[model samples]
Target: MVKYNLEPSESILIQSTGVCEGSGLMTAFTDELILTNMNIIHVSKGLFGNTKSVRKYPLNQVKIINGEAQASMGKSTNGIPNLQIYFTNGQLSFKFQSSAKKEIVKYVNGISKVLIGRESNLVANQFAIPGAEIVAETLKDTIGVFKGTLGIKSKGKAADEPVKATKKCIGCMSPLTGTKGQSIRCSYCDTDQIL
Candidate 1:
């Protein structure tokens, strides 16, 4: 059995043993592939079984290619389907038992779902407007200042008195209430507000 450490939130989703075709001396060796929620672990044991090497690939960076068609094509020369996992730097091909085709397909589907969901979330977050609440508050405050300057009474408050100028804290961007040309310190971030 292969020994590996799983993370706190990681668990084995599926596993299978197959002959792995990797680069360099790691080629054509039978290794155990353990699929976890966060990563795919490849465990290869040395000839003596005393030495072993483990490699981990993040699930987000893994891509399953031509997995579904393997069932019909049987592309390998030995009449077996090869499960190809593509990474950013290289690729790994594994030849598993023909009976495990269903499990492999299921694994591919799960990976597809994860990748799609991750991509959508990234897009959503990337285009999201930052500091929207701050912008809205600033707009409201600007409108109030304009009203006070025009001597427009708001909510039964008298606008006859001079309105104190407001500036934003340099560090925290919080509104600072003070007179023009006065220096104030922000209570939130302790930043000096120079107006």
Candidate 2:
């Protein structure tokens, strides 16, 4: 596995056995194209065990703008597959001789997932229902006593408990007395905070 500059947890998502196109028409070179969570790594290994060139494109800096398979009647993996990527600082096109369009699309999407973090594709909006709240009496003393008797120092909660905050209706500014996150209906306003 050619990690290139990948972090310890990074793993290859896609790899293609293909030759890469050079700047000139007659220039082509064999390379292992690998896509990982952190980068796109292109490694060219020399005939012997010697000269090796590795080019890494960090996922944070690149975006896949286009990907398509060559419409060729020759063979499934014979024609060249293309993927166009726009680096935040620049742009480039990668042509693979031994790849297909769908494979390229899958790899492009993998890159996008790494860059954009997981997010829902569909769009939806829901508003919170109005509600009346009732905050309860302070329980810091009880909580402190409970923890001390158990000899427990719970994570995040300090040794000295903080005072509980009061709740109020945002719409009417009416003082509410209840526990945090509890759903309660405001009898005066007929508004409800649903679960």
Candidate 3:
């Protein structure tokens, strides 16, 4: 088993190609250090609440048993082997022990920033989301993994406005945050429509 230790002052991104079982985008997070078995379908499929329609693969659950991450990603009776996820101290790490030569990058606070331009080469077209791409590149050039801490970068400036629902005129997507008191003016789209 190959393990990469990460800390608060650093971040690691690994090629998630074979890490997740299903086809759509797959990303996982944990605190750090402690391994957690994951049920790949548990996120979208309702194991706790309600079950949705089954898709291409009907995986129900996964668990880490004695150094192996077993997953049921298909109709097979036997579980497939995969890496276990480590979580502790608000930090998350991934372990991969496969023949696939996919890369994982580790980054620390002052030492490096994920080069977005470099990620353009690694992940497939569909896997390229805003945050996922950043993680992928960071793991590519991980000089060393830090322990007991995690390094995080602020993505963007936080907006002061609290996110509230706006009742649009059912036509245009406009702000109606203050439309409750007055039916006189929309001041938004200028539409006289009332919710």
Please provide, for model 3 over 80-163, each residue's C-alpha lDDT reduced to its tens digit, 9 standing for 90 to 100. Answer: 222222222221223322432232322111011121112222123323476976788787446224321355433445433434
What lDDT would each prediction earn against the true structure? 0.61, 0.56, 0.30
Which window of 10 residues has the lowest lDDT sum in candidate 3?
107-116
Candidates 1 and 3, the one with greater TM-score: 1
Cα TM-score per model: 0.45, 0.45, 0.15
Ordered list by lDDT, greatest first = 1, 2, 3
lDDT of predicted model 2: 0.56
User: Once superposed on the true structure, which residue ranges of model 2 sit more than 4 Å away at CA?
Assistant: 1-5, 21-24, 46-51, 63-80, 117-195
Runs with alpha carbons beyond 4 Å of true place in candidate 1 = 22-29, 47-51, 63-74, 77-79, 117-195
Q: Report the poorest 10 consecutive residues by lDDT, candidate 2.
A: 119-128
Worst 10 residues of 1 by lDDT: 66-75
Estimate, for each residue in 1-195, the C-alpha lDDT of model 1 and write its tens digit: 586789999888777765454333335445677778788787876655543678898876764344321111123555455556667666666655445455455555555555554222322333359988789999989999999899976764554444578877789888889766677889999887667
Q: Report the error of model 3 at residue 84, Å.
A: 3.4
